[model samples]
Target: MNEHLTDPASEGPAGGWGSVKSIARIYGETLSNPAVLETLKQQNKPGGFMCVSCAWPKPANYHPFGFCENGAKATLWESTSARCKPDFWNDHTVLELRDWKDHDLEMAGRLTHPMRYDADTDRYVEVSWEEAFSGIGAVLKRLEPKEVVFYSSGHAGLEASYLYALLARLYGNNNLPQSSNMCHETTSVGLTKVIGSPVGTVVWDDLEKTDCLFFFGQNPGSNSPRFLHPLQEAKQRGAKIVTFNPVIEQGLVSFVNPQSPRQMLTGEETVISDLYLQVQSGGDVAAILGLCKVVVEADDDAKTLGLKRILDVEFIEQHTTGFDRFVDCVRTASWSDIERESGLTEPDIRRAGQIYVEAERVIGVYGMGLTQHSKGALNIAMLANLLMLRGNIGREGAGVCPVRGHSNVQGQRTVGIAEKTKLVPMDKLKELFDFDPPTEDGTHMVDAVKGLMSGHVKGFVSLGGNLLRAVPDQRDMEVAWAKQELTVMVSTKLNRSHLFPAKAAYILPCLSRSEVDDQATGNQYISIEDSFSHIHGSIGKRSPASEHLKSELAIIAGIAKATLPVNPKVTWDDWTGDYSLVRDLIEKTYPEDFAKYNERLNEPGGFYRGNAAHDRIWKTPEKKAVFTTPDQLNSLSFPDRPGRYRLLTMRSNDQFNTTIYGYSDRFRGIEGTRDVVLMCAEDIAEAGLAPGQTVRLVSDFEDGRRRELGGLVVTQHALPKGTICSYYPECNVLNAIDHHDELSKTPASKSIPVRIEAEP
Candidate 1:
């Protein structure tokens, strides 16, 4: 753990993307006892806190320490001895540090003081919090408010989330590029277009009633381990679970419940999945299409073959539009085309469709795997389409569920963080805050990055998040980031964002929500919305990381007070002193589920935010769930084409976003490396590539930029011919900045077109 302090030199095979390799290398050399336990014990005391990197919600009867390996590392990193003093920055230049490895940047440790970059010396010089804010405010005042884009990450709490939104509106720019833009933006784009909301309609209890669950593109073992217990319970009750993904994840295959006593003591594990389908990368579109085709055929042949109609004719006749167009869309799609694009035969699609027909109720579960693609929104819409064919929506055990990355990312958007349609009317804002709201649509991450890079964006502020690391073509991204006139990152421990400084930058340390948030009134509770749309309140059970740390809400209020002091129209002081006031304002502005939110959150586990779709009514303009028929997609025809392989970039079990937890992908038998690529034996030989050769992958995109993954270990895994799997961020350099969904702007990091061959 101590050795992780040094600069990173190596990126492992499968976990090769992040600083994990360097960190592991550090631990392998430095720490006498690399396995540092007692993090929760030290950080979970009466007041001190741990990092929120891997806080997977536990089961009702589970212990507080039920978190996985990543959680432990995050907690340890929080309470570790690593510190970034002024001397550290004084010792290194910003330009020089940018060239360092990803792991080395993180291992640099907790930022002790704020600093601003000196362009003349190309170094970061320490700046006081006051001086930093004033310097930043000067930059903001110099440009139009629209020139500033206020971004946020999930690490930020309710107070900070609200403060960021408020700051955006007050500063005259609604350009708030949030973490949601990358992670669950597809969920939002698809769901909101179908219904009125962006979150899943299913609740946790619904898992018990489901007859079958279709898990897609999500690796629970690494992404969200807490899901395993509920899956076990559902399995015990005999729910048929099917997993659809390009990679055969171990968590989906089987796992021993560490939470169970006998299993923990005896080293026994439980079986998880019933079926595994290695669908083509970015082929979620094809997979869903093929499944729907089988359902359609089954429905068509029902009368003669003793089959039941999978299409809900009655529901479609009454509650949908453009059924004829949808029917034609599916009917026109050929099986051969689906097979070529999906890398799965017609039989695989038929089998999956048959299972859906057999189950009385079906719940569709997905995550970033299905979202980070060019056709992601369409893929999500297709999942809903398949479920709707069997009348799955509004049922007790069936609906669309996206396992969100962070704890409360959904809740932030539900409140006032949104810069678009959910915005309260100008009259409402005037009535509540005595001001006019902005009419412009706020800039998302893609647009924000472009805006900043082009100099249209001058000032930038992030509540919490590593914006540069999360974006694609990472090497080129820093140049765009460095162009910001002013940048402020409100965070807990120091991260890449601090080192990726601006002309004027401030790293205002803040208290994690796990730590007690003190106010003039008393210890206050904050609320977060979960994957299942449950609105629960959380109060810090522990103390702040340090006395110098302030609540995110407090820090935001402080900035607002310092930056917007000249006007003093509304009571910013009221918000700074207490977060409850912000809650009250939320109630007034969006008074739907948040009515009496403060009082409601005080109750244990919070309450469910109403899902109107559960009642058999959608909030669409037509008031019914419509079948979306997107454009027909065919696999790479490879018409006399050569040396092409479909590459699907993914994250390891020990990482989240840009944070690498450790150096192992336990499920894949990948240890001490992340540089390996999973492929079929036929594809390797067909491309004339040997097993242990250094290789280069060229994107089929017109940009002609080549991605080289040197020294890759080739495995004759189950990955089908023309399909390959590699770790993300490392391959993100190949994904052009503009390569994304036109509607949602979600980075097509998963479904990039590339050709791989051994490097000579």
Candidate 2:
């Protein structure tokens, strides 16, 4: 807090890397010895492993001063000086913590012991591990499996998530709500309809083979650092890297590679993208349609127009369906409409289209921006259709990549986390364990909140994550959470979710992947699947964040043992004491690929469990990738809500999801602030407002719900005339808790229209 020594904007533009490191640490996530040591233990090396905090997913061999500020934050968070304990929540009530800021809630520190909610005191009290597990099982056993929802987070290790999926099936609950529902649900729905699998089609190695990359709404420098090498290589090779986003992200344009010793020493940086398309929010679908139109038209004059032609007559004729209809769709779409909807003129759209046509192989990578809209699923489908037009689905360096947020978020969903997708293992479990899996699809994140509020959801056992901060409408979600009859949070830290206690609630503190895993027997190694579907072993090197902490695997096992007293075949309690037993069960219950789970995990960096993308053979009903046309192919229509501007939710460059790493957003030129709303100059004039003026966002949540948030005004970039941008979490109050995609059940986080008033 020494202002004299601080330079707010020390490493100015073109100096992104220099300022990035210290910037993130100042916000709630500071790096420490604990983080450094745990990273080292991942490699079982002397120096240290690269931090996965921000985007530090660099190659394993990337040893030369690799990692960014956010990555450092992650490492520090993993190996924090703070400790979780039973008493952590003793002084705070569910109501009290509900009033705390998101960062302040997490800043309380990691969870250290098992806890239970005391209805009389309205506080979380320390409890014996044995008591917690027994209570969890007894409550779960009493409820209809249909009424109990098991929510999993990406933070859960392979063993913990595996056990959760197994237990859910054993108890017969299809309500396996997950962190994925909030993040990549669109990718799952969209990719499955087109390619038969809800995973990225490209491998980590395939980044080298790509001739071009369409980076859609991904902030790699802030979110995922590991891909820097591949992106840098693509840039060096002249591969056309085009970025489409509402804000012109500086990280996507250029970033310094901390791994490059020469670059760091000389203060040099690498340019990332060749083209920057500031597509208005929710305009991705339109922008993509524009490209499709150009490709279909350019086919006629490929040579003269110098277009990257993609007729692919032979492939389209044999491999895909609805090509004729799709082509017609492109032709009927006029340039004026495309320009109006996309906010990019004919030349920019053409230029983007030219890059697509010129490259034989194209990879489309996206983040939450493409997944959090009303038509998010369709947006994904549009990308798939566009890729299919050019035969890009199965080709090398030509596929879709959804850069996942949390470490094992995708892996958890892939292995077992599913409330809806009929898992084959559930039937297999009934046959093996003699319990019928629940038939009804259970609650999603938003649905769970509603169910809790309605008193239909009696109990919740979350394996990981802070559900309170992560969900939409904190005010409503907290109210709903308080209504639950029983809530059990199996966690690594103390957070707001614990505050939403029921008559019986528990916060079971557990080990972090960045630290060594241990049960009664010995140390254990956990597994995580990366964005590229690479399953790597992550072992913690640091001492426990808290000595009283238990691994998530152990706690779940305790619950299983406590709940299923009549289980004849399994010794759930015995396995609860040791994680390796959990891993063994995982290898047995799922695919055979995880058979050599332990030994293979220690083999340097780790290996893949096999992505269907590798062989170009999909797992569709036809044994070939299939394309699906949505029952409706219409774009979003802003209904006549008088005086309302198109309000889009945005993550400040300094923040990630609900995790506020800092208040400063270096990218958009905002610093020491998180409350500012980004607006166009015309809107500032139209509203008769000045740059630094304060305003209130008046929202119309279709169900007659309304909210007002105040913030400073920022008039900078050229946003589409009707569109306005504001930070998420702050603006989450505007979103309707009941509104979401009927299928994916993802909250409409990106496109909610609102009206701005002068702090009324």
Candidate 3:
């Protein structure tokens, strides 16, 4: 829809004129449709709706305007006046709608009623909510409990996600795969292995006190705009902010706060990164090890000079294990190996290490770029090791911060939305609910896909999310999913997944985050946890998108009640009527953190879920943080072949995970299309290609299989010579479900071996 061409050189700088353009874009929609203003009024306010965007923690004193550009876009799109009513579907077929772009499908607006796909007519027909539920129940009842897969989204509130998980467990299955699989599973699995806790140790307040902030594979300006404020504050305090990423993102280079009048009027931008290092794709491990090597060498030299050693000897001796083995690894690491793998100079690595050595307090912030790889878990461990060198964890102003996506992604996991861990303890479940919850480990996202392909999994009930579109190897996944006996999607808007249904499919419409949930008792509010582990309540004041629409909580209850015979102990109806009952259940389930959940949620900004890592208390068997020594070298080796390069998939500035706000990436200076690949100028020249030439990307698999993506525009960028970059979903074809992190089982989306060929 963004028809104008963008300058191909590069994204200039974030904030300044770029932010102004974003604000103007929002007003263009708000002035034309006033409903957007209504949504903005409730966002991030006390006792109002939460922003259905990133999982960044709310400021102690919340922003008066209450949102950033991306937040505004999310609100405006959700609050649109347009609607995909029943008649609209009568004129369009699923096959036809499948051809539309993701943005166009979103522009079709909110779904107003339940609809069932008609195979004969190839269209979706309006159906009552009862009929839809009964139909789904009938199909599910005939299948084995293990045959069904319940997929949840991070966007869903705590009540709905918990109920969905409960329904799956009650139905005798543990195949509870949520969106965390594709996004933060590495953070969860990896961090737990290292420190025995998955969540970040640092709180929002830590940013203000940190003397040095290291950002690896994260772009905060676009992904988490609220973080820019603290980074700016840290800059003013003379704190050094260093960045290590494959691309030198414009957001990290500079930012202009739209809240400031002078900045808004005059384009005065604040430079963000004190040092920006463009590490190669899948090269973060090498870069970090190189920095660690410098630190070890410096400490050794200091010891020889009879000076104070840089390493935290006291902390390491008392609170950690396997340090000697890790030290041996770091000491033996060669500069040539690191330089070749990271594509960074020895001086650059030393400079970053020197900054860390001088800073008294430091924070390490990372994003998906570090997590979506075959060695993702090791990547997380490397970060932990770097911070641990100076005893940064568990101290004020210093710790590991894994930047997350979604509003309640961390919350969903907290309230029992996991596959492996049965946190609810079977004894507790029996005592409280009188139901024998299943204890067997179930499938994760990647395994779920394998189950579907093998015909072992036949039924799917999505509480939210466009799973089919969001997954890797879209074409094969789509074909495999079509063989299912039944598929049900509970969504507020129609996404690509709804179009490709199983043998029997249904789309159940639900209320948006900005709409009030008028339940049997009265209006209800649900709580969500932010990335910083703060649990807060969100109350939507706007009316429902449609009268027939139901709350996600009610829908889960309806489906559960329809599928299973009436039971007294579960109290599905009672929990749906009043969300407080759900909170009471959650409190009993996870008493360690959620005890007195309702009472604490009533507080001004909610309560913090105390992290064990924050108190320097390791939950491992050894009761100490252990240094992880990876089996493989920190750097990956590539075969000597012509035209080979590593492709890293990422999101555009105007997009969230799998949800495209628009085709243009305003911060990246990419407009009019997303069908472009960013390659280094040196590689472009080596390949004998021009700056704006067209190419077909072919992914090289270790198994000798190849995946080709055609018609991608090749644009020259300042990327590391061996690596290239492209937007996801469009480039998802290059990813295979089997290509994933061994420990976390996260699809290796960020690091794919590929080569480009001239477009024929």
Candidate 4:
């Protein structure tokens, strides 16, 4: 596992030769049969299966391949030719498998049967689906409704997520702790408070028409490679793209379109960013404040300088409130404070501000780098203010775009997957489903883990994803998982979470998005919503990997029926038989938005789930977009301690969230290892450390506990002084569960105060 293969990159661009090699490597390793081709074909065709890699909006016209390299990896990982059977489990025990790597565990292949943890043998033994359901139901019925927590992930389809929420509420608990709590909870909470909606205003089509696109802490080449196509087109159309980040990500600099054979063969790359600003860790708020201050200064001197007015005075006067307070806050922010906080000079901030002043239609794009902080909500508010200052909302090519992580994460929320009771409106549930939903607010991820540790959460059910590995404080999460009285996981493949068994644990295998679900009513298809609120269907056309595997929807129905044997208020059998019935119920719940859910899926490119901000329809208490002025002084203050670096957790180019596709980060010039740290050369020299030196990272927190990780090989890069980077989940140990955004409860993975030392 410690074998390091280093081939420092010099020439090839991302998505050109690197992607071809990666795709070939995936096919070679997976040994996927020809059936995978049909799986991919259905994945590309309209109204077919949608990619579960990311929530990036699909184009009106899709590529013949219809997916990126990472998307292909996710597909191949799901549709691999390997299988983990009873024999495989008999050969290895849970404690022995604990030594396996994350990718190795995923590579163990799909689970073909329902398995239950046997404490005597310390292995998972095959069990009947009925036995698994009955055992889990026994615990569910014994515990109080509030004691059970239902966790959901973005990988689950909207239909399954809706049924999961319904089942949890019907059983009497609203403790719906979802993956969104770890990814974009800030965007969901912050944007709603500012512009009266949880999603972004602009659609995918707007990228082609935008005059200027500002990237705030987003790396498209790795996270969303397909997004690069629109960016490439926008660049060719004379759109000015500015990027703000800490590290010099290769994806933001240049890209070679893999779809184009000419560019792939010849090294003709498309330049993405016109200007790159390297801000310090957790400095987005300061950088944005400085940019806003420069914009206001330009507006003040527009007439005197013989320049056109930059700020939309009419839009501000009529469509916004608190502009006066925002302006006052920006005016008082001194350049000295901005430069110290942002690690950028006054000229650098103004230069980017000048570009913003000139563009007519602008869109601001951001990812977890901006939202995974203590001041995440305020950071989002400031970005909204920047967009609103120029009348960016209610337009075709202007608004904010929060690049979401998992596919259908947004769709799940739309169909009803939330911890807050008010977000779903219980009265509507009572009207349509005849069930009185829980009125009390449920626990989020942080609180859920706390509840599990304190014995408050007795029973746990997961729709998808490895909750233990994905959450912060890995040690504590494992302990919490063991404390649960009953734990049931509905999954397609084997993962790390299954190894951490509870007193009563069951692993129920479910069909993946690439597998056809044959229910009582022929085939069933599920729909998902993209980042831009585009609703489309994903009908799996491939055969099931194993006959024992059941559809997630069917499993949910079975569990619901088993848990409430006497209840007849809700019809789980009816919804599971025909998925359209679920859609009909969804339409009744959201009459205006999902009026013709089935008919809309039949459209050429599916239907656009209209954005309220796009139409200037604010659903806020003030009935207008509100401006927020965040305190610059209260920003994440770097400790005065010497030799401490602000370590930011990042994903390798080949990895997506917790899923490691490979060991190489081809785009970042690191190959053959995820066990390395990226830091500034100067910082290494300052600490008296040499190149390729092995070191351990010790996190500093207010709580009197030292979290340390050793055996990391250091690599020097052009990172900002006192800044370092490491891959997530591996570095997740350094992140204290309590160290999170106060407003959103999202872990501060992007900005953690740590001190590096030589491994002893």
Better of 2 and 3 by lDDT: 3
| TM-score of each prediction | 0.89, 0.91, 0.97, 0.97
Clashes of each: 15, 17, 0, 0
What is the TM-score (0 to 1) of candidate 4? 0.97
Count of clashes in candidate 4: 0
What is the C-alpha lDDT profile of model 2 across 538-586, one tens digit per residue?
5566778777777777777778878865677666666666666766666
Who is ahead in lDDT, 1 or 4? 4
Ranking by lDDT: 4, 3, 2, 1
Name the best candidate (by lDDT): 4
Residue lDDT tens for model 4, 1-760: 0012111342345678888788889888888887787677666457678888998877767778788887888888888889988778778999999899999998888889999999999999999989988888888899899888899889888788888998888888789988989979999899999999998998866787898999988888789888888888998989988888887766778889988989977879887888888888888888888889988998889967988787898999988989999999999889998888788888988989988988999999999988888778888998999988889888878899999999989988888789988889689888766667788899899999888878888888999888888988888778889878888998877888998899999999999887888888988888888888888788887888899999888899989888975556578888888999888888888877887888887454557878888899887789999999786532363453786678889988878888887887876778888888888878888888887999999988668888888889989877778779998888888988888887888988888888888985
lDDT of 1 by residue, 659-753 (tens): 76455665565677777777777887777777766776766765666545555677656665666888876777677777776567888777677
Whichever of 1 and 4 has more TM-score, that candidate is: 4
Quick one: ranking by TM-score, best first?
4, 3, 2, 1
Shift in Å, residue 41, candidate 2: 7.5
lDDT of 3 by residue, 399-460 (tens): 99998888898899888788875544667766876778888888899999999889999999
lDDT of each: 0.68, 0.70, 0.84, 0.84
Worst 10 residues of 2 by lDDT: 1-10
